[model samples]
Target chain A: MDMDMSKNMERVMKDKQEGLEEWSTIIKPKTSVWNLYIKEIWAYRDLLILFVKRDIITVYKQTVLGPIWFFVQPILTTLVYIFVFGGIAGISTGGIPKPLFYLSGIILWNYFADCFTLTSDTFIKNQNIFGKVYFPRLILPLSIVVSGLIKLAIQFTLFIAFYVYYYFQSGIAPNYSAILILPYLLLLMAGLGLGFGLIFSSLTTKYRDLKFLIVFGVQLFMYATPIIYPMSSIGVTAKEILFYNPLTHIIEAFKYGFIGEGEFNGLGLVYSGVVTFIVLTSGILLFNRTEKSFMDTV
Target chain B: MSKVVLKIENLSKRYRLGEVGSGTISHDLNRFWAKLRGKEDPLSQVGQVNDRTAESISDYVWALKDINFELREGEILGVIGKNGAGKSTLLKLISKITSPTTGSIKAKGRIASLLEVGTGMHPEMTARENIYLNGAILGMTKSEIKKKFDEIIEFAGVGLYVDTPVKRFSSGMRVRLGFAVAAFLEPEILIVDEVLAVGDIEFQKKAIGKMKDVSSNSGRTVLFVSHNMSSIKTLCDSGLVMSNGTVSFKGDIDSSIQYYLGNSKNLNSFKSYENLDEKPGSKDVDLLEYKLIDKEGEVIDSFNLYEEVSVQMKFHIKKLNGKIYPNIHVLDKYENYFLVDTIPENEIPKETGIFISTFKFPKYIFNTGEYSIGLAVTSFPGSIVHFFENPAIIFNVTEDDLSLRIGPSTGMLPGVTRMQLQTKTLKI
Candidate 1:
């Protein structure tokens, strides 16, 4: 053991004398859990942007309506809910216009859903490219988050158009002070969705049964949040269950700021922020671990 | 000597044999049990895999083990091996696509590997978009790609289709575009894995020239892996031979090729069939012994670049009616026949009982690579025949004298007329 240590010391000294200052890259079997390769991800930011562009452009490149489909999807979904849940089921919208209420909740929920589901399939969908090339593995999921953010912005603009249209008809004006919290709400959504997606993406590579469950999982997750219905009508006991859900606070706050119907608690927002931080950190940790050997199992 | 840029030490990788997810829970439990007791992987056997036996008592197999080598700046190292020789494993470890199971690889500069061209190119995207996207995926900054955008387009010859979608382009056009983007990468270290097998012959030559130009003109280091020996001989300055997950030989390009051919193809400079019934030829004439001999009458498989070697064959004829002569066929490593030697009709030997024939290949007449000879003892070409044996015996000629080699073998090897050393078959 002593001889081995002395030999290593001698080798290190010899390497220094040979002027081998530093290595730019070193690959090994077991790296630390916290070595998430953030520097590499930063260097590859351009690739992230390009991937987002490819998703946006290629999705509508062959469609007849092109970018118009982006608006049509939300509008169609809003009408379905108005018919099924509003007119037929006779559910109350807490005195807000049905179109404005459903549209706001739908747009924000779509952003979160897209972030979770798209990134969850990152490793499986990109096996070919990942096997052949070397880049930061986090770039693909990050790109999904960015592209979903852009889509959310567009749909939020549509939501605002409806807000003003209904403002003249029914006097449903947004709370300007509450609207300032919208950016913070979106950040929470991005972080939470990105975090859960990264964890599931790593897990699904090893256990493909999770892939089948995730689509319905996202759908069931939507109901657990305050997307289809208002939080005002729920009982205190039931509301407590929904309050514990981080997404519940985000969706409720987004609605309260938009049409002034749902409850907005500062404590709940802080709780959601803390949850987001925890999930995001763990997601990155799991993602870094899986990226090292996913090619073998994937 | 140049500074070393890439150093691999004690590199190894182990992989599970069967399905990854099937019954993995039990295996994980077993692994936990083993590790808690401080034991090696319970599912794997010890020792390296080899040509004879690879059957393991456990479910895991070591794909690579204890590999070590280094590459200096401006050196082009060609990695050659048969299937399942762990060549791809080594490349994956170096390129950072997959982490090694043990040991480490330290590199000085950016390493770009063209494992497969058009890796991330989407068909729905335009050619211009794909070029940008592909360049970025290969680790080029947007500004760097923009600076070389025109050069890339010109090299790919796709200026007219810049705005057109890539799906409309033919497969050949896509390959050209992909390679053009990578050729302008200007990375300090490059690793390529058989990507040259695609495209037309003309384009393949152009790609090889581009790689050579990069390594030579800019002092970049490259590790190229290919099954094509001619390409390896053409583009690489040094060579590494792999067999069954281990480095079999590492040396100059010529010796590595010789070593690989001799090892993988089971070629030898000598062969003898002492048994009467198990010979290679027909019953009428059977070969007894065949070998290569030097000036001291010593059997040798290898010689310096400028040295004389002789092919000596001994055979016995049980019955012979008409004229029979022994002919020799010499072929290079890629099996291109270099020469065919036979006696004139009048000078042919006949009525043979036991015969020995020897032919001389003069000094400086052959290039530095592996060569094999085919033997035939036959009657008249138009009529009856005795027998023919091909790939009879293989020998290697290597050159350590750098002054003798013109350049990396870019074109045809040296022919007989270039050195002008000729000799006829002798009855000894």
Candidate 2:
């Protein structure tokens, strides 16, 4: 109750209108939500670099074959999918070489899956540091997206090698559209992963049982994502259902854009982009609010 | 007086306690039902939580309530409290690690808190890298961190190891390096919590000295929370003593320490049992409770320092009262044990229903410190049957002529009773 404090309090009270502020209060929540989406995360760019470096360093520490695991994980996963789906199940790789087809899907799908899984556990994984300090909480989930992108880049290099080999040996030309739309595809994957991850991260803080469900849920979600088989192989009714799968449009558009024989309607890609934007925006809002009071609950 | 740098008003934090058991969910539902209908919390109102056990099923308690205080620029304020007294919660609130459920806090400049040693330091990172990383996390700019990088290294006293991974450093070395970086970051407001409790005495001294320099040289406000009374007395200009989450006493360091010590000494009743578990150095025989009374058998608070104050003890000897004698000692506020007096065995009566002894303080010889009485009934000189050291009963010595000296001095001057000392004066 000093004069200076009274003056400061008056300023704060003036900034906060009483009756009319309620009508505009809806705007407050929305802005808090949108502010989290990209603006606050962009400010924590240095933290993103540090987290990316941390993720890379921590993974290879104490292992003899360092950074090689980055290449080995996607290669082994693609081989397993190709053997099971193409060889045993008699699935078609859409007339494209099986390795390139499987490698491409694995590369794109892993980025989304990795981002989703890591983002989902943002609150739980860093509970120790989060409890003791306050920074932009979005820095954590955004960093996960960035680090997963780095990993995707390394795996994508392997896919590039496969693409070159397939071009020379089997004479399949990668459509020029693939090069133009590559960055947008990356954004679509990041948006979807971040959206799903943040939703789960917020829910898991209060209901810890969701954390267990998320692990198995992400596994089941991968099978449903059409990574092993193209949407063209499903029956007509199932194909219609697959269109409702928002990620299907993005992945299908990517395949058609790159391999030229896959599905690539511009409107379908736009629908996928719109859905990604909505999820990313909503996820940021939920995440921003959750970070403010999570210390009390978590 | 300096300018105010940080202000906190009407802060409160509530915590739900003891709802972690098999049937807690059902109990919590019942309590919530009671609360919704304008009734008090069911468990808390009824005191249903068993007092005998350490755990309870109470619904909620305010860990901190209505805490208000301000800090001036360059002032070092120490927060002292017992366990469960919400000292850490206050620090966490000011650092903005957590927001208050109510109230507003405003700061004048960037605030950095060293709530834990080497917080956010990745073990895989080298010492040099961790300095930059932790510094940036504490709100220091990259250029600011780089500018002090050499000074931090020098203060940590770990040259050539700057390139070594932090995991390779010893725990003490890691703490030193972490603290060194925080000190050099040159924040406008520094918040530290019991991080100095780790490391050896040498490092503790170094950390304390560095904190002193940081507060004095840079004129940065510091909020320090510690359980160590001596450390608080040495470092803080003002102290805040918290009890049950409210500011109970705020003023000079001595007054706050006095308030804290006074709480521990419950002077409600003149009679109590000297339980060995409650007090140290107590053996078999039970010396129930003792009261400081006058010749009229009336309990009193102050003594003339020249008049004899009698402590009457009620006890029972299971075996023999053959060589029982009472030993008393006077301790100051800092717990520097001063005088020890022993009663002769020959003066005790054979029937031991009650025993009393009176010792006179000649003339207020002690300095300005909270003085507490300690009583011990010993069998012979070596073994103690019941002993209470530093009991809650506290008093202070007041004087008109106590000159504050700058440095360490040796010798006893003109006083009624001279405490034995040797003085030396040499010209440099």
Best by lDDT: 1
Which runs of model 1 end up more than 4 angstroms from their true locations?
A1-16, B50-53, B268-428
Candidate 1, chain B, TM-score (2 decimals): 0.65
lDDT (CA) per prediction: 0.86, 0.73
- lDDT: worst 10-residue window of model 2 chain B: B45-54
Q: Which pairs of residues collide in model 2? A: B265-B392, B272-B288, B305-B361
Q: Write the per-residue lDDT of candidate 1 for residues A211-231, one digit (tens) a residue.
A: 989999999988888888888
Could you tell me every candidate's TM-score relative to the true structure?
A: 0.78, 0.72
- Give the CA lDDT, 0 to 100, for residue B315 in model 1: 81
Output the lDDT of residue A225, model 1. Answer: 84
Candidate 2 structure quality by residue, lDDT tens digits, B259-358: 5664545442154433212423334455655566655766555544434456555555544545777677777666767777876556764654545566
User: Residue B296: error of model 2 in Å?
Assistant: 21
Write candidate 1's Cα lDDT for B1-428 as tens digits.
57789999999888877788999889889989999999987776777473326476667777888999889999999999998889998999899888998999988899999999988999999999999999999999999999999999998889999999999999999999999999999888999999999999999999999999989999999999999999999999899888788886787888677667756655477655533236766667788767787888767888875778898888888777566778899998989989999767665556767777888887776777788889888765555556677887788887766566544664546553236434577899
Candidates' chain B TM-scores in the order shown: 0.65, 0.58
